[model samples]
Target: MRVLIAGAHGQVGHELLRFAPDGCEVVALGSAELDITNAQQVAKVVERLRPQLIINAAAYTAVDKAESEPERAWAVNRDGIAHLAQTAERLGIPIFHISTDYVFAGDASEPYRETDPTGPTGVYGASKLGGELELVANCSEHIILRTSWVFGAHGNNFVKTMLRLGREREELGVVADQRGCPTSAASIARALWALAVQYREHGSLQWGLYHFSGTPACTWHEFALEIFRQAHALSLLERVPLVRAICTADYPTPATRPAWSVLDCAKLRETLGIAQADWREELAQVLRELA
Candidate 1:
């Protein structure tokens, strides 16, 4: 089976390349190599590759910056996806797209389900939701996997940011009111590889929207403290900084973040028979890699 991976340089995309299943031919393309936003370019590349499956990891992920660049955000998130869905539908190939948890309003007391109503709070979230809708409407065979708070050894993410601050500062402030699961890119890649293998072997997969994130949701403050703890244990930090918990108002940004965007993965487990990984264990592995 031949698989095409867009956004190959991203955190999850890079991991996908590294963890690609055996006996499968993988063609990974970064934005520079094949920009999804360019419809002609996308069509030409997909036509040339003729991959059996396409995994779209490309996205405009600047949450705060999306407020000032909605057009760019929509172009990459929504328009790019529309192009892929149409092309894949034309070629009779299936697509696996990654989405985010920001599609929710974040006011729910319990975890958000796949059937929950979407009310994106910021331009970034709204654009991603648009992409999901476009993908569903344009393609018949597709898997839209929504996740949250993704981090990894590679890429600019919360974990890397916290590690950098911990090394440079004695004190750091993180939002305590907001809570969500921290998923590892490596885990996501592994899950995608498993799904791809299943599809290749069985010739079909259960399609539709699904949620898959790390187990044990936590606040940014708690995540920061854990990072410091692990970094200290690894001797990667000369001195672990004091992580101060603060409300959303204490640290303002251009985008309004979800106060509680935890997603329930029961559907994923029940339908796909996939289990959620312990985030702490994944964090330890990432720390080891960084060290």
Candidate 2:
């Protein structure tokens, strides 16, 4: 199978490249090589590579920044995806795209299912939702994986931020009211590969949207405490800083965060046999890599 991975330098994309299975010819490109926002570039690359599958790890992930730069965000998130979907549909190939939990309004009391109502409150989420609609509208053979609280050694994430703050400050405040799964890029890569393998073997997969994220949802403060705990155990941090539990109002950002971003992953587990990874275990592995 000839697989093409966009955003190859990103945390999840890096892992996807690292774990390229045997017998698969992988053509991985960073955003510099294949700018999805450029429709002509996308069509040209798809024609040149002619990959059997296109896995889009590329995205405009700056949540707060998207509020100020909606055009940039939409160009990359929505229009870029539309371009890819068009080319993929032209080639009759499938697309495995990564999405976010931010698509939800964050007001749900329970975990957000795939069928749950989507009401994005900010520009970033709205743009991502637009991308999702474009993909569905353009391509029939596609799989959308929505994840949350992503962290890895290869990119800027909550874990790295907390680790840096742990080393610099005696105390730090993290939003405790906002709860979501802290998924590792590694875990996401594994899940996507599993889907790819399933498709390769069966020649088709149950195509649609699914939620794949870390297990045991936690608040930002709790996640920060865990980060400090793991880093301290691994000797990555000489002194674990005090993590203060604060509400969303304590810290203001250009974008409004979901109060409850937990995604119900039972559909993926039951359908594709992909289970939620323990975020604590994944965090330990990331810490080890950083160390």
Q: What TM-score goes with each of the models?
A: 0.99, 0.99
Question: Per-residue lDDT for 1-291 in model 1, tens only?
Answer: 999999999999999999997898999999998899999999999999999999999999999999998999999999999999999999999999999999999999899999999999999999999999999999999999999999999999999999999988999789999999999999999988888998998999999999999989999999999999998999989888988999999999999999998999998899888788889999999999999
TM-score of 2: 0.99
lDDT, candidate 1, equals 0.95
State in Å the error of residue 92, model 2. 0.7
Deviation of model 1 at 55, angstroms: 0.3
- Write out the backbone clash pairs for model 2: none
* Model 1 / residue 257 / CA error / Å: 0.3
Error of 2 at 194 (Å): 0.5
